[model samples]
Target: MKYPLLLRFLQYIATLASGVGKRKKLFILIYHRVLDAPDYMRPQEVDIESFDWQMALLSKYFNVLTLEDGLQRLQNDSLPARAVCITFDDGYADNFTNALPILQRYKLNATFFIASGFLDGGRMWNDTIIEAVRNMQDSILDLSELGLGKFDVSDKSSKNQSVREVIQKIKHLPFDQRKNYVEYIASVSQNLPEDLMMTSEQVKKLDQSGMTIGGHTVNHPILSSIDLNMAESEVLENKKHLEQLINKNVKFFAYPNGKPEIDYRENHAQIVKQNGYLGAVSTQWGVASKVSDPWQLPRFIPWDKVPHKFMLRMCRLYCA
Candidate 1:
């Protein structure tokens, strides 16, 4: 069966299971870039209009709560009916410019997990790779010499696929190796964009204005791929940096690439707990429940745009 049809059937069953009523589980919605125009180079981005609509829907149908409050409720096993928390990973400038307004319009609060190393005019390695790949002068650049496979960047679709393939190949590599590879690509490609991340001032302002600022590693390195000491440093340094920058305690964390037992592991969760973080979130898909591990909280993004379909997807999550 087609994916959409399957999903629709599942949603229907979920609706029947609960009469499409709100569940007691806590839903943490995650996002990345909220751009006025969708960043073609970063296809994972949500445009401002779509974001506005989503927030409006959440405001109307869900009991959106602050991250701290939601976590406390989860801890006490007293999560409100249909509890929800909004979060943005990899603090982008557009979070301040685009997302902030929509959030404010809905009178909602959100937590932003910042990769400290990207502040003050720095870009994540993935963004660097995307910029480099998108700007390549040659349609079919050969990288077999680097021991990576050759790419066919003959058109927009091909270039996008090439970018994804290269990033997938290097993402789980040790941090230094991935950085070097991305830098090498940037050197060979042309017209790399500058400073895609939020500045220290922007971060400070966001925190001051009531948004929770959280840590997301120093350079967004996958914790399980690096040495334990390095991973600890990444987690600790990011927390300390955000604390000093925002002049407030950085309480929460989100794992880089956040896959359970893949991008991060048990030891990394231990590191986060040892660092005094209240809890850490992962890219794992599920609603938060009383039995859920606070140190490895799972989160997911809702992708449907149609209102009823989106609501049904939320219903599915509630039942899942």
Candidate 2:
């Protein structure tokens, strides 16, 4: 659940105090899309103005590095008292056109993890629904008539919980099953462009901008739901795919729907390390410490509206 305003405000106050103890961890921030599109129907949770402000604030106290550089600093014991790295998942086009300029302006670099399937014909299941919900020209979809069974998409309010519930329903099936289902729904709901992803050309732009690309599965799936053989294949195939496409050895990963106890498991970590990834990240909200599993590195999502209070909460994490 997203945190309440006041409580999160207090949390931001805590981020300022992140300088406690011997200071032995790295903070990784994970992002998806940047908010700047004109369509409210396609709401990106992280906006550009908010991102600008947050990075400005972060720069004052932390040395923002790319994910690879962060790992290297940790390995060499040369990270600053408070260090932070920026990473993005899914090779969204915005990461190329909207995001790279900002990071370049700040002289900070980031790592972008890609879902190979979507590079040509892939979209995360949730995003397919989101794009469709945005372009409903009729402003209403009679989902009951569509016979979605128990799941209802008729209520088209743009509220967070409403959209989340629908996503959960869509993601309920096994990985392949759910993605195919979402694609079917999207095709009927609103016919979108064939590619909502960064093309090979776009990825090259990011690489030129000093952004490293990491492997994030061939198709972004909840890895834990599939069989062990499928899971290993998923990881290895994505690494090989990205290595060939980007012409660089992909050494890092951020699990899709990355939660340590839920979306990923110990076995996933073993394969990642054995397959030659230097580190992998999870959506766990604490800072990354030496004791922190490199294969299970932690990251926090920066919301679209990052007020000063939110900054305080982030500061507290460092302090805590």
The numbered model that scores best in TM-score is 1
lDDT of 2 by residue, 157-274 (tens): 5433345666776564688777666766676565665666888888877887778889899878788888879989999999998888778888898888898868879999998999
Question: Candidate 2: misplaced stretches above 4 Å?
Answer: 1-21, 37-44, 137-161, 304-307
Candidate 1 Cα misplacement greater than 4 A, ranges: 1-23
Q: Write the per-residue lDDT of candidate 1 for residues 1-320, one digit (tens) a residue.
A: 23687557654544363443434578898899887876666666788877887787678667799888998988887765667899999989999989998888989999999999998898888888888878877888677867897898877888888989998899998778887888788888876777689999999999888899999999898888889999999998899999989777899999998999999999899999999999889999988887889988889897775556767778778877
The TM-score of predicted model 1 comes to 0.92
> Residue 124 lDDT in model 2?
67
Candidate 2: C-alpha RMSD to true structure equals: 4.9
Best by lDDT: 1
Specify the poorest-scoring 10-residue window by lDDT in model 2.
152-161
